[model samples]
Target: MMRKTLTSVWPLFFGLGIIGVCIGAQGSLLGIRAELEGFDIRVTGLLMSAYYVGFLLGSLRAPKILQRVGHIRAFAALTALASITILVHSLIIDPWTWGLMRLLTGFAVSAIYVVAESWLNQAANNRSRGQLLSIYMVTMLAGLSSGQFLLKLADPASFELFTLISVLISLAAIPILITATPMPSFEAARPVSIKALYHLAPTGLIGSFLINTCYAMVLGMGAVYASKLGMQVDEISLFMAVLVVGGMLLQWPLGKLSDRMDRRSVICAAAFAALLFALVSGQTGFAADNRHLLLALLFGGCCFPLLALYLALTNDELTSDQAVGASSTLLLVGGIGATLGPFMISLTMERWGAPGFFWCLAAMSALMAGHAFYRRLIDPLPAAGEPSSFQMQAPSPVGSGLMKSPPSEN
Candidate 1:
């Protein structure tokens, strides 16, 4: 059964892997490049935040696009736009132009995730759903993590890295565009309002926003922070790769543990873990000691899965009918947080220097852990039925298979 599932989805997965590679490389590439160009830290923050702003916009608009053009055409168009935009970053050196392109890239990438996840969800049966989603997460992590190594392939100052990213994005289209599989049908669900979502699952809603804020800080500014600490490109790539792998390693175990007990407990533990790591990182001077790899792993493991945990926490309180719509709400909330995190962190960094990065992380972690414990005390209600099962998340509205799985014919 697993073999047959792989056969059916190989083309899609292969293409998605390429997309993962592009995404992983592009953010760090731009951040490193910005540092090399001597762009102001706050300006770089604005540039990075623009992507999340565009992402929020695209996530809202993408369902309509997928509905109109269908998946194949929508995917093709978005990838082509993203491909062109990434290469343009190399041609133009201005922060404003890069900001524009970064926004476009975010817009295109978010929609592409909608396409990829929506298509995968439609392809699964009950038995295959878990297997497929598991494979999907692994493929994404492996691809994205491996792509970090591509940093070692060329100088950050040269156009070569950007070109490599462009080439990967372009090649991703080939497998997807050529697939003979039937296109998935799509319908945009009416999203629950933030007020409604908060009322329903305060912990989940607030957690999503807070955790993603920290996440975006790291994603947008991590390379920049590392560069500021005087690390070389090769060391930066390895450190970055360690962060990705750390998240992958912990997501499943924590998810399984969440399914068995109060997820908020796991959520609290994870958040506290982050706080501890952040404290340690800050004290250690944010890579002052030689344990750059260890600090990166501990940091990634503690922080990366919080959004997914919050997604499940929200959905645990939702009826199946509402789960689909809430996916958009949670993603939008996270995106908004992501949009603001970098600029805020950049200000902190400017004020305190490199250690400011970990300080911001520690504060966010404290808030998340404190809130989760507080909410659990105030509202202890569980889902009316079994809680929604946790999955390793992909940060897309649909593709992460966060919605209750479609009823199985089998």
Candidate 2:
């Protein structure tokens, strides 16, 4: 399955890998740059959070646009937009300008993801789809993590890194543009209402939102936090890289474990574990020692997998027919959480300084653990039904679209 899928679908994975790298580098660069540019934490939070706002909007709208222009043109146009945004950051460093640029960049990236995953769906069959997705998760993470190291190559304060970011975003378009890929048909997912989803799987819905809120803080504002703490460039790059790699390595093991038993147990356990790591990360002065980087790896390992776990838990409550819509609904819920995370966490950072970042993290983890524990006490999985099989992904609007696609026809 791996061999066949890779042979047929390498271009999509390759192109996406480059995009992942750009995304990783761009976020870290902006966060570090924002600090050096002397933007207040509140403004930085708003700037960073704007991406998720654009992301959520793009995810909702990308299907309609793709249906209008077709996949190739959509990918080309979106990539061009993303590339342009990278350069714009270098030219204009104002908080408001960057906030708007962040929104546009998020929109373009999210739309590209929607189109790219649709392209992959056209390439995969049932037997190979799972393998393809696992590979996809790894490819995206590897690129993302590796991009963090690119920080060492140039000064975050200079135009050079911005140029590199724009070049990579532009370069990612090549494999897709040159390949003769078919446009996969778009049947816009009718996401279940948020109210309905909450009632159906309260833990899943809430857990999805809360866990992703944590993820956004760790990813989007992590560099900013490191910068605030007086970390050098190499340390900041390592910090972000460790978090992504943790998510990459642990997602499958944690996800596959959930498939074997009650998923809420897994979610509860993971949440609690994250709470502990969050405590250690903040209270211990994570910046005080090099060894503390392990906290990020552990925190991310526990938090990232919950995205897939909550999706599975929600699906376990749903009929196969309802699963797809619910998945779309969860994406919206989580995306909103991600969107708010930076701003909310930034408020804490403003009050408490860098420690406020993980204090907010610890508080959220505790909340997640409490809620999951409450759900586990009140609601349990049925003995008669099996949980949905886990789908490992670097979940985004595009990745969510991949998960909601038709079950593989082997």
Candidate 3:
């Protein structure tokens, strides 16, 4: 019975894993490729941010496109488009050109997530929703981690690696395309009003943005930061891997703790921890001969979870439907922050040196933590038994303009 059950869900798990690999490769490869091609760090940051701009724009429009195209068609079309976009990177050298390609890739990939996640949600039964979601999460994490290691096998300086990733992305379509089982139809996108959500829960929304800003900055430039600090390409991969790995290790405990206590408190604590780590690690920079590996690990472990925790905490204040829409909106906001994070940090790094990148992150983290603390005093907490993790969070009136209707149920 157990074996049959496991086998039955293999396709969905595999599909989600592919999604993870696609994104992980995009994030890691873009950073490395930008540097090897001799683009300035700011350009690299701008290129990465271009993707987020695409993401934000896509999130708004993708639902309409998906509705007309249908799920499988939309997924296939976007995946193929993304593959082509990535492949173009191999042929092009100009920063603006690459940035445009990155934008298209981002828009397409964000739609892919909407389609894929909706499929996963549809396939799951009430009894198995949690299990399936957990499986999906793990697949995503592993696929992303695997993408990093793929860096080791390919030569980063050559176009072969980017082409190889494009191939992998193109191949990812096979399992979904060939599977005998039919996936779910896309949910019709809905309008998620920023004002309404703000009146509902403020802390989560703001925290969501802050956490996303941190994450976007890190993913966009952590490797570049490593390389500038004198680590080799392989070490850069390992550095990114360790940061993600630390987040993986802490996600469960931090989530559980948030469930039990004041989520605001949890977020504040996590941010403070991130601030401390970033201060130490960012200030010291990586030294000769991998002297700072431990600092990096500790820094990653401590700071990465702050995003997840803040997210989880934010969700704790939302309704189920609200949670879904709110999460997507928050994701869009985070994408914005992520897009800008690399560019801002890169400029700082160029002006003041490598440590400047981390100094920015530390300052951002501290500001967010302080904001959460202030909200705790000014706002009323959610009632007990609210679905914290899956509900859509509304920010206060002051920040209410950021909310939007849920993405259309295509």
The per-model lDDT (C-alpha) reads 0.83, 0.83, 0.68
Per-residue lDDT of model 3, residues 1-410, tens digit only? 43454566576567657656767766887787777777888888888778778877766667677668677788789889988998888787788888899899878876766666566555555666556655656666667666677777777878887888788887877787766555554444343556665666667667666766666677778777877777777877887777767666666676677777787777788778878888887767876666466666666666666665666665666666666666566665566666677687888788878898778888887987898789878865644555445211111001111223223333
- lDDT of candidate 1 vs native? 0.83
Shift in Å, residue 177, candidate 3: 0.6
Best by TM-score: 2
Give, for candidate 1, the lowest lDDT window spanning 10 residues: 401-410
Q: On TM-score, who's better, 1 or 3? A: 1
lDDT of 2 by residue, 1-410 (tens): 66765776677888889999999999999999999989988999999899999998888888788778877888899999999998999998899889999999999988888876766776777787666766777888898899999999999989999999899888888987887545676667777899998888888889888877887787789999998878899999999999888887889899988888878787779888988988788876655657668888998888777888877778878877777788778878888998999999999999998889888988998888888788778766442467777877674535454334533221
Instruction: Summarize candidate 1's per-residue lDDT along 184-243 as a digit string, tens digits.
Output: 776677778899998888888899889888878887888888888888898777877888
Candidate 2 TM-score over all chains jointly: 0.95
Q: Which ranges in model 3 have alpha carbons more than 4 Å from their true place?
A: 1-6, 288-291, 380-410
TM-score against native, each model? 0.95, 0.95, 0.88
TM-score of 1: 0.95
